[model samples]
Target: MQRRLITSVLLGHYLSAFTALGIPLYLPRILSDLAPGTPGWAIGVLFVLPTLCTALAAPIWGRWADRNGCRLSLLRAHAGLFVGFLLAGFSPNLTVFVLALIIQGTFGGAMAASNAYLSTQFKGGDLSRALNWTQYSARLAMISGPILLGLLTAQGLGLDLYRYLAWLPLLAFVLILPLPKDAPKHGLASKKAEALGELPQDMPRLLAVQFLFSFAMVVTFPYFMPFGEQLGIGNDALIGVLYSLPHLVYLLALPWVQKHQGNLLLHGLALLAISNALQFWSVHAEPLFILRLLSGAGMLLSFVGLHRCLSQRSQKGSAGRLFGWFDSSGKWAGTAAGVAAALISQSFGIASPFLVACLAAMAAMVLARPLLMTSREIPA
Candidate 1:
């Protein structure tokens, strides 16, 4: 049953990726073709609006899922993605495109829904293993989704390809239809302060750590292209290879890392701090490629550690609400990181965010210590 659930969600997640990250990957081109002469601020709005809406709406969906069922919530989320992508694909003007994004954000949250849905069925190491599988699907999609779109773009299909891709999430919606229902369990982890009544004491701190990790890592994304250009590496293929290498590491290393989990958060954060900081001095692609690989290893460790922490702490009835807020936390962090990256790059240069991220990683190490120690006490 567990294997079936994992396989089902993983496949659905892979299909959902076309509309999820795929559209965002090509948004600039889409806007240029469909809504030419868009202002700088509007471009930012186009980038940030759907994310902001997702962050705001995730908790609401989570709460609703807790009352109804996670399966229903998961279905609703995919449906929203379908509608949002369809609207954007067929949008007649900028207003309609913006509305489409709003609809997408307001309705779409398959990741959080999937997590909550899985949490209903597993706990401890089993839950972590399940979540890790989701990561594999996500990483694979991230690497391939953009590449697929780029290939189509090269073939002269143009923006119409994105429009055609709107129907992709419907595949996910259909895949979810066969999953078993998760009935609501009221106040299952509410604050009665017992082992079952309340969440782990470190959950708030865990969320903060999540925010820092996201902000630090994402701060580098906006300017990575410019940073590569600064190092005289203008080949798009090489840059794409560098960008995708870290995810590839996760694909190869995550299973081993999860099997031998011990102080992963600490080691991962330390490695992440060093790797991010060292990027500041990268004068060529060779060293940058090595650092990116190390960063990928660190990322896998940190993500597995943190997710393990979440699964260990998640009680049966409250998983929906908890994963909901967790996803919101990460979304807000990404939004903030984008703004901060823009400002820091404008003020200091492209390399400054790496240093900022390094500091953030170090700080996360400090905050995560208690949580990690507490996590160690949970039975494997």
Candidate 2:
């Protein structure tokens, strides 16, 4: 039964991620079709607007999950995502598309809710394993989504792709229906307070570290296709593969890292910084591919380390709220990073965001040292 439940959760993430991330692969074309001659900044706005909405809504959903139940919260989120995707698919103009995205963001807390639900079912090494699997599934979706989009778009179905993809979240919703439902429990506030006491003295610092890492990541994400084009890789399929290769590496490496979990925060940070810096010099495909693999490994290490820390600090009853805050922080950071990337790219150059990401990663590494040292003293 436990194994079945875990499988369902993984499937849920995979489907949800495919819908959430995959549909966006066609956004540039969609926007072009809907709003011809749109400025580059508009693309960033379209990407970030929903993220900001999601950031705002995550905490409320988290609190609801703590009070109501993770399963119910997840169901609600998935339903909303389904509707939002439908709206986006049928949108007649950019205004409708933007509204649809906001709706999607407002209801898209499935990942956070899923994490919270699993946090209740496992702890210690088992918890780490489960979280790593969840991340792996998400990375798998990231790898496959673009490839799927590229194939669909190549066949001249680009305009109709969103409508087809809209069914995915509904499928995810159906998959989640068979999972065991958690009942609402009392004393959640007290449990949260207790968890707070168990948290490290510099918990805020860890949150800052998470924010910086996410910001660094998002700063370069939406511009990858353009960046590849700048490098003379014009084929959509090739660009999709370039975008997916790092996540593939990350997915493959997750199990090994989960097995050998340790204080790898600093090392991960160093690698991530180096990888981002290498992007500046990657005018060719081979070097970029190698650097992307390194970046993926680095991201897996840092993100897993942070998530483990957060999970360790959460009490069962309040896990949703805790993970909710973590999700919110990352979302907020992503929102800002999206806007910053657009403005930077517009003013400076297309390549400037990569440099900015490298600098941010270095800063995160500097701030992470104290946390890393302190984490070593804590018992796993």
Candidate 3:
């Protein structure tokens, strides 16, 4: 039963991630088709608005999930995602597309929902393994979704691609139907605890680090294709490969890192700094590909490490709210990064965002040093 639950959740993560990432890979193209004269900054707005909405909405959904059951929460979020994808696919203009993203953001809590659900099922090494698998599934989707979608769209599927792919999560929703339901464990009690001023001590610092990590990671997403174009690579399929190769490396390296999960927070920060710095020098495809692979390694380490940290530190009965706030912080930071990236890219050159990311990563590494020195081991 536990294995089945894990499988279901992992599949959900993969499908949901695939759907979420597909549109972004083609966002620049999609915008050009819908609104021909939109500037890069406006492109940034489209990305930022949804994340801002998601940032605002995650905690609410998390609190609801803590009150309700995780399965019910998953169902609600998947339904919202389905509707949002349909709305985006069928929309007549960019305005509706933007609305679709808003809806998507408002209801999207698949990752947090999955994490909260799994947190109930496992602990210690088992918990770490489950969370690592979740991250692996997401990274797999990141690696494959773009490449496959890019290939199909390149073959003349065009905008129809969105319509076709929208059905995937719906299929995943069907898989979710058979999972055994669990009762809400600490709904009202957790709220009462919060009212009485009981909160995790390390939460604020963890959230700050999460925000910085997200900001550094996401700031370059909207500009990758444009940057590639500047380097003379225009084939969407090839571009997808360039973008995904890093995730591939990350996926490959995850297992080894999981087994030796020592001071990953520090390792992640260092790698992120190096990866972003390398991006500033990557004017060609080969160098950029290598740098992206390095960046993926950094991202996987950071994400897995932080998630494990959160799981360890979560107060009893408050996992949902904790994960929700964690997700919220990342979303908000990502929203800011999107806006900053657009402005930076517009004001400077396309390569400037990478430098910004590099600087942020360095700062995070420095900020994390004290925390790392104080606590070096994952709590058992």
Candidate 4:
């Protein structure tokens, strides 16, 4: 049963990952077709809306899952995404498209839901390992999603690609159907426990670490392309490879990292800060490639460490609620990161975001110290 559940949720997460990450690549084109002369700010909104909506709505959905069942919440998320995609694919006007994105964000948190669902099945080191697999699916999807969509677009699917992509969530919905029902483990009593301040004290602090890590890392993403261009790496293909390098590192090193989990969070943050700092001076492709590899390695260490921390705390509280807020913290930070990147790049240069990221990573290391130190003695 554990194997089946993990496999199903991972597969479903893969499909969702592909759609969630892949579809955005074409949003600019879609907006151009539906609303010619779309303002730059509106295009910015197009990029940020789904994530912003997801950040806002995740906690509510998570609380609902604690009362209801994870399976139902997962199914509902897929269903909501299906509807959102259908509306997006068939949107006749900008208003409708915006609404579609709103729907998608509000109802589509499959990855977080998957984490919560898996948390119910595993705990301690096993839960960390399980979460590692979920990240694998996500990394694979992130790496392949755009390339596959580019292939489809090259095949002349063009704007209609949006319509075809809508079916992915439906397929994911089917993949989830065979899993045994995951009834609510926490129920309403856990809610009262939390409201009465009876849950674990470390949860909110862990979430702060999540937020800082996410912000520090993602703040560098929006301006990465320009940063690469400035480094004399102008090939689009090469840029894509650079973008994928970190996720590739995760695929290769995550298992080893998972097994050797020690004080990885602090080490990872230090590595991340160093990598980002080094990138500021990388004036050629050779050095930039090495820096990216280091960045990927740092990301892996930190993510696995954080997952382990969250898993440890989930053993003491409601997994669904904890992972829900966990996902929300990252999403909210990610949204802020994008805006901050834009402002920093505009005010300073394309590379300024890296400096900010380095500072943030160091800050995160400080916030993470208490958690990691205490977590060492916790079982699993």
RMSD of each: 2.3, 3.1, 3.3, 2.1
Please report, in order, the local distance difference test score of every candidate based on alpha carbons.
0.83, 0.78, 0.77, 0.84
Residue 337, candidate 2: C-alpha displacement in angstroms: 2.0
By TM-score, the candidates rank as 4, 1, 2, 3
lDDT of 1 by residue, 33-84 (tens): 8878887787887898988999999988887887677888888988898898
CA shift of 171, model 2, Å: 1.8
lDDT of 3 at 318: 62
lDDT of 3 by residue, 1-380 (tens): 88888998899878987888666757777778778999987876675666778789988887777667777777777777887888888889888888888988898767777777777677765676687788788778777787778778687665556667778778778877788775665544665665542346777887888889889988887798888888878797787677777678777887777787565877887788898888777777767777777888888878767766765665445667777888899888888887898799999999889899988888877776665665536642
**Clashing pairs for predicted structure model 4, backbone only:** none
Q: Arrange candidates, best lDDT first.
A: 4, 1, 2, 3
Instruction: Output the worst ten-in-a-row residue range by lDDT, candidate 3.
Output: 190-199
Model 1: runs farther than 4 Å from truth? 186-198, 376-380
Tens-digit lDDT string for candidate 2 (26-65): 7778788778998977886786677788889887888778
lDDT (tens digit, per residue) of candidate 4 on 1-380: 77777888989889888988886877777778789999988898889899999999998888788767778888888888888888888888889889999999999998789988887777778888888898899889988898899788677664567678889999999998888776564544655555642336888888888999999889988888888888888797898788889889999987677778465888888999999988876667688888889999889989988988877777433666777889999999999999999899999999999999899999999999999878853333
| Candidate 3 residue 270 C-alpha distance from true site, Å | 0.8
Error of 2 at 244 (Å): 2.6
Best candidate according to lDDT: 4
* TM-score, every prediction: 0.94, 0.87, 0.85, 0.94
Please give the lDDT score for candidate 1. 0.83
Worst 10 residues of 2 by lDDT: 191-200
TM value for model 4: 0.94
Alpha-carbon runs more than 4 Å astray in model 4: 185-199, 261-263, 376-380
